[model samples]
Target: MSKKTLLSEIKEKIDQLVNAGFNNPTQIAKRIHRDLSIDETERTINHTRGTVKYHIHQSKKRKSNPALAQACQERGINFDNVGIAWNKDKHWSIQFRPSETGPTFEEMLQDHIDAIKNHNFKYEKIRRQNYSLPCLLVIDPADIHVGKLASSFETGEDYNTQIAVQRVKEGVDGILQKASGFNIEKIVFVAGNDILHIDTPKRVTTSGTPQDTDGMWYDNFLIAKRLYVDILDKLVKIADVHVMYNPSNHDYTNGFFLADAIKSWYRTCKNISFDVSIAHRKYFKYGTSLIGTTHGDGAKQQDLPLLMAQESKKMWSDTKHRYVYIHHIHHKVSKDYHGVTVEALRSPSSADSWHHRNGYQHSPKAIEGFVHSKDNGQIARFTHLF
Candidate 1:
């Protein structure tokens, strides 16, 4: 056989041994002789050991004298090719096999670095466009049961109405700050249902009669309304405002009332639009996208997409991009469903703990937030805005 052909045959044999987990030199040499039908007398097993030891020693030597060992360990390294050294202190190392299966370590690392830089450039380019323009901050502040109490896991600190409100304020502030950085066209607010405590009268529950002051329901509604209005009024300074309201089952009777009151108040405010329609319906539209808000009470968890699609088809048949933002389960599920993207939002409520005892414990600890870009025809994109 020609020298080149013989060398190629030897390399293939070595690869087969490596893949079979026969790393020991003696066993590999014996297997090679058997497979190739070489004369056992002419082919000494010691020569095979020598070849394996030479390759291993070369790899170790590359760590110190890389210039001399590079040609033996790497491909395309003629005397004229440029040379590079190995970094021994790195946590991970990559070794090339004779099979030529994947890129060398240095090449892979360089590609990864270049990819990161490209991604960063794209993000910066997006940020530069529409710089300092007013942004339309769309937020779903759902299930903020003001009178609910949280356990140790929910809050490191003890649970109280005061603590819940404070925690929610932090989330609201984070969303506001993120939205402020973008060029906001308008701010759309969707207050999800279960905003207040509608526990049965004092004699019923195990928590020794839940607190319900005379104006507790009304006062809680006022508190949530005032907080929401104050935040929106501040955001409106940078952009126009639009509000969407959806009622939940827990407080559907009273929650709808509170939602109506806020909508009525917004009608009086200048430069702000309010849409207080029925629960579980498409209540807002932005460009080619139509948003449907629901408290997630009527349908099963797995049936959300079907429910939203059916609702969208009925409400606005010409809607290009359909989105359903629901709160109640307090878990975040973002995925494409039957050509539409469905999202189950996480809540800023302490009452989510009650769900755990009932065997539903996938809710997110941190509140969920999202930023929708009208520039792209996308329906919804979720983020932990807080």
Candidate 2:
């Protein structure tokens, strides 16, 4: 057999494994290695992971877009045999060749947009019954990672879209239940900050490198959008809702999409408001207490307070009690920067293989919230650990 023919065979196997959602190089190698070992005719071949990666590149083909793989998977269609090309103009589309009759990337994109467009949110005008002490209920759903996947064997913890959704639901329920006694006047629903597991259709971060994902980007976006809707519905019944979005490292672009969609969803709802702009740093005022939120990927911990003051001078001066909520580090961190309090919220998200293998483990998965009083400021705190 010619060397070129052998290379072609190896490339074909790589394409098959990649289209089946084996993105990691090591995982792909193991997958194809088993294939070579099982087939009697190919039993004599000795190939490593590095060689497989080389063949993938040499074949002038890359891994199939996760979005296309997911759409095909849903329809019980194998994307391995389908011809796909990556179009980067808009939101990374998988342009398919005319031969295979399948869902076009454009159609999938339109499906999500249509879902957002046709959403009819029936917001019943809800007014809180007989309130007493006034306080702000800040529910920070830190690092939700809605579509993240974690293997128990690889990460020592099991997590997926279902687990993520469950944890968020459980966490939010616990916080609200615990805060039931407080006369919460304002519900500050702090969101974004990596609520999604992936930004691009290629299952990568904003920087364009592949990452482990539980589902397709569009599917996950819809799920997360629904989750936020349910959450806001509950919160609005309690008090006026104020939605804020802080762009995160993983899903900055998609996060904005979710945030804006929520804003549009609550357009008719009088009590609901939004701070869903592109700024990574965002500020909110609850009487005298000033609050700032950011994804915490760009700036240093110590620098946040200074940045906050510099960015919003008028708010910093007017408010007596100033606090900043930063998310990215998946554990609890509280540091008093003298006049300003800089804190990082804890995450309920279980680490994936990459995080677990690299000692990114933090135990006692939980959600945290704080109650800020007008006169006293941050008078109470709540945490629900899973």
Candidate 3:
């Protein structure tokens, strides 16, 4: 084969793999190497990982918008993300994000507007039912780690993006089924407690700690977004839902962005409310029961009771029963303090390389839920084990 033909074929292969979701250069290189074993082609181009990366960049540059690409080049900004959405109206929306330069305030606002416009959330107003035995149901699927990877051979349990999604759905269904006997007036869906495994494409946490990841960072973000949307959609049918966000160490920045995206998604819904702020601890009061939520990485467990009381002084004074649900340790620890009960929830994600190596194993992986009476505080606890 000719040298020109070999190079063209190499570029084609690279494009095909990238479109098929193998975005990493090393992954594409291995796949192409397995498919094409021609000696002449190997000698002509030598499709190493670096060569694959070059071809991928060239391909992306060719497909990018000329004016926008030029502006990014002038600003020394690298395109960090590219996405395509196909609407039911047969229209396509293409988007890309600049890593270094990022977007202006106006552009960010426009993106949020576009997100709402692209998809129609036909949410009809859900009527509230008068329940004789009213209670607040708290569904805290803590430490999901949606993009974390764990091989059964290494960690004694297999985990990936698919497993993470499945386990959450099953766990939520299980909790709802268990709580079906009670009249659920309101739901506090605890979100953003390390829902994503990584914050950056470099396979690292927000603080730059390296991690073993499963899917691409963007894919995991979308997966978590869809998961939250689906859960909220279902919860709203049963009762009025309140989404509480708890910013965690891992995926701290991305987690906030995800919560905002979810907030935008359900902007039209009347039955769902959100507390997607960047607060380290979030408090919600239902009747005489006041519940606090935190990711629990920064503040110590013993100090949580005083912090809750200090932070939400009005709620603390008004409510008779108080509880703070915390996550991050992936194990169970419950302590009743002077006026509050601080409980660290369990996680559904299995141990990855770091956790497995450090002897963090066998803590009964499960998703937990709590049923709180109007004046009696937390009455029932639901556990869905893996």
Candidate 4:
């Protein structure tokens, strides 16, 4: 058998010491000196700790990564069983592994980004005359949860992508019907109150937590964007549409993607505007009312009214009525504080098995909307029950 290289032997000793719990650099250096008789400088060891660990992790990962394993095999070495030890003596001993594995998720995402920039995908929004109305209609498709599956056998209700889509459409129609007598000039459509049931392709939230979902994440994403675009397109004919994105706990990353997709869809349209900023608290001024929207999953309820006032002081001073809209609780609750009304909007989503089993059963299945007048602030509230 060929004798082990000096760097390999050093790396092996370090790994043994590390596995034996010699974590601190001082401790590791002492152990190396004792075991291998190598005068490894303490400061050098300290600096090298991160690199060593990273290489060790990479080595472990390479085993599971078929291409990496195959490349190491071709080199008469196993990257899985041995970590790469870099020093002044050698650099880039190995780069990519050779195998027939497909492109990574990151590679696919980058390709998609490149495609967007090159206009391989077409996006266009209509620009219409600024037909202002006396009142601004606000809808909270809040907690829409587009790809959630709930069987009546479990939750006493049946829900899926189709039901979620239909409910939002019907609820908005109901709100329009109720406001038929009012002259509305603009609409504010707040997206991303858990608009997606999960954030990842693996049916999980942004934090890598799993969720019960109705369909694949891509399917859900398309379904969500389709619903938002459909509703906004319908409303644009009657009034100018102001779109706001409020990222939530469930789909932080993908929700932003969905929001941006909607913005891109209406990018060129004059009748539609967007607040696609990834702000936790977004403020919009319509007529005499100053309105703020958030996901409600973060921050204390009491702090929000004050936050709204402090964050949008100029708007607060200019408007007679101040209100904050919140979602995530999936039910309506209102509180008045220091001249502001902070209210949580209701959602039309039926309870999934988790919610049903947990006794989160009393929330009314409905969607809510608000009417803000040019001078009087919120004049009416519309609720469409499931």
Candidate 5:
């Protein structure tokens, strides 16, 4: 690229950053580092800061450089990707790119305001036969916490057994509504770990202190099994179902329990298919795509991607793309790592005051959703349902 062209590109990137709502120099520096893979040395960091300052200074001056000024006027750049690197307090850096990739900040902001509108518009545009494809519904009924008293930690308002069941049923209904709207032909029900309150037969507090329950552990198990069966039967009526029972920290025996029940149930009901296993494991074919799911309790949060990568390498070497969907965090996080997409699905429960007390919050209300594979199974897109 010529010097003039290069300067124009950099100027456009800076302008984009400013327009994307990034004003801090440190943020701009980080974006540059990510986009260009620039070294984070003092010199390079200082250079990025100086570049942003100079551009702003020039724009304020209304300089005679017509090319630079014109590039700034176009202002087609998006700065949401811009980021900053900080060291302690004194040192800082900025990074940004010249063009928009993925969704722009403004687009995302607007999406939050009118998700249904945006979704409808996009759906209408792509509703033609050529784009119509069979969608898969991945249902995750996570952390039921049966037999536990619902306190402030679980919900903003105190919930008795009846209220909790009602809330769960509402979530299930919402999921079914969303799935019906989509052209979904199959359902992957991932029964998350912690299907019960206590991990073992012993009663316990939320913090795992020893306690007692009114009924036997077997009673709790039966209650959980009955509820799950009811939910599965309802879903099977809507679509062909494949249930994956993942054992969790609270209910270490849930996987085995679900597996046995499903095995016996399948003998009686020929329509609903079933696949059950322990959590934190390998991939399975959902359609033409390979999907890996877990309850997300085995490894540290930061190490999950590495664990999934190693597992996917061995289990899905032939697959074009690999996805690992996890529950437990009760928040949504989608990121690409080591040629695999890792997604943390949000929970449908309103009871999560512990998260609120810790100062964590996000919009559209935390929901349960599914990952739809696209690009001939090379990419996965998460669509929030409930």
Candidate 6:
């Protein structure tokens, strides 16, 4: 065999050894060195201990990611930011950031489309509402934190995924009953103000802060999804609905993905529209009103007015009344800037252990809604406190 062929054979043998539970680099090297020394033909390779160590490393890497190595070889591009975590079962978990030339944007987008299609969400068409009133209903179930856990013994309040879902349904029902007096033409459902307590299966937020969680990450996600779908179904019957997603810090990435999935779920519903992008702040225009929604973890309260004006310039200019609803403080604070009103809405989620220990349990739990007129600005505000 050629030298290249011999080297490939040696690598395959080392990989086989690795798969057979020979994970100790030093022991594997000694075994290979001894085997090669004993075999006269394989002795052509005078593999020193250092050479055996190199081969062992290469074998482990290849075992961890054979397809990735082959792809890199074919594309002539190396992957950076490689990481390996050793398992107790003598296996390695490999992770790496995608290479610069890994997948084109179109390819990634197509993959996402295929994934969405694979979900096979049952799509039902929503009938168009013919309400002739020029009024808008804004329902914001803020800071639900679906997976958060709080015990009555520790935090003086019991909160869990079940409580979180029940509160949203109850709050929305209350808001709808109160707003029954108004002639509504449109409904804006503000979503994703830390709707999830944890972003990862490790029971932590997106930024890696450990959390007091009540349920599994995926279970809570499904619970929140069902809650939103149920609420949107009700809202669409009353008026055309606009779902605005406010990306938050706790479940930032997961929240965006959930929002995207919701949008896909209602893709065929003509009465529902979606703003599910990853933008931290989202703006919606209603008649003479310009409303902004944000998670309130980013940017200073004082700066939101100018930021709103800059971000939604056309809406700011066209509307006579402007409001920015923010969450994450869990308390209520409303202030009118020079031309904009910034309101930090209250949350219905009870305090978890951290918040209760930190003395942040004073704020009353509530879900808020606002009613706006086409000619006038915000005419009514409703708070359903739990």
Stretches of candidate 4 off by over 4 Å are 1-133
lDDT of 3 by residue, 1-386 (tens): 78788666777898888888876555566677678775634552324555675666555554555565565567786633433212233575655442322233454455356446657889988889798889999999999998999999998889999999999999999999999999999999999999999988778999999999997776687689889988988899999999999999998998999999899899889999999999999999998989999999999989888998899999988998999999999999999988889999999999999889999999999999999999799999999999
List runs of model 1 lying over 4 Å from the truth: 1-135, 151-157, 199-215, 301-319, 351-363, 378-386
Best by lDDT: 3
Cα lDDT tens digits for candidate 6, 5-124: 655666666777777987544455556656544354555232533354456545446555766667667877553334432223347555553222222334334434644554555546
> Per-model C-alpha lDDT, please?
0.57, 0.80, 0.84, 0.77, 0.57, 0.80
Could you give candidate 1's per-residue lDDT for residues 1-386 as a string of tens digits?
Answer: 56466445665787677777765555666677777776656556656545654443343444555544455446655422323434344586544322111233343334334323333222111112254433345777777776665566753324445665676777767777655556666667777466765533231122333443322343454466666656665656666667777766656555665566555555545666776666565456665566767777776656766666665564345556666777777767766766566777877654335444565653554555555556454533334432
Tens digit of per-residue lDDT, candidate 5, span 232-347? 66876766677776666666654465455545544445556666655456456754467777778776556766675566565455666667777766667778876667777765
RMSD of each: 26.1, 14.7, 13.6, 17.0, 23.9, 15.6
Residues forming the 10-long window of minimal summed lDDT in candidate 5: 119-128
TM-score of 2: 0.72
Q: Count the backbone clashes (under 3 Å) in each candidate.
A: 10, 0, 0, 5, 18, 0
**Poorly placed runs, candidate 3 (over 4 Å):** 1-58, 61-115
> TM-score of the candidate numbered 4?
0.69
Q: Which candidate number would show the highest TM-score if scored against the true structure?
A: 3
Taking all chains together, each candidate's TM-score versus the true structure is 0.55, 0.72, 0.74, 0.69, 0.54, 0.69
lDDT for model 1 comes to: 0.57
What ranges in model 5 sit over 4 Å off? Answer: 1-132, 152-155, 205-208, 211-216, 301-306, 309-315, 349-367, 371-386
Off by over 4 Å in 2: 1-113, 116-118
Measured with C-alpha atoms, the lDDT of residue 345 in candidate 3 is 97
Kindly list the per-residue Cα lDDT of model 4 for residues 130-233, writing each as its tens digit. 54557889988789898888998878889999999999999999988988778877889888889998877667788887777886676577678778878987
Candidates 3 and 5 compared: the better one by lDDT is 3
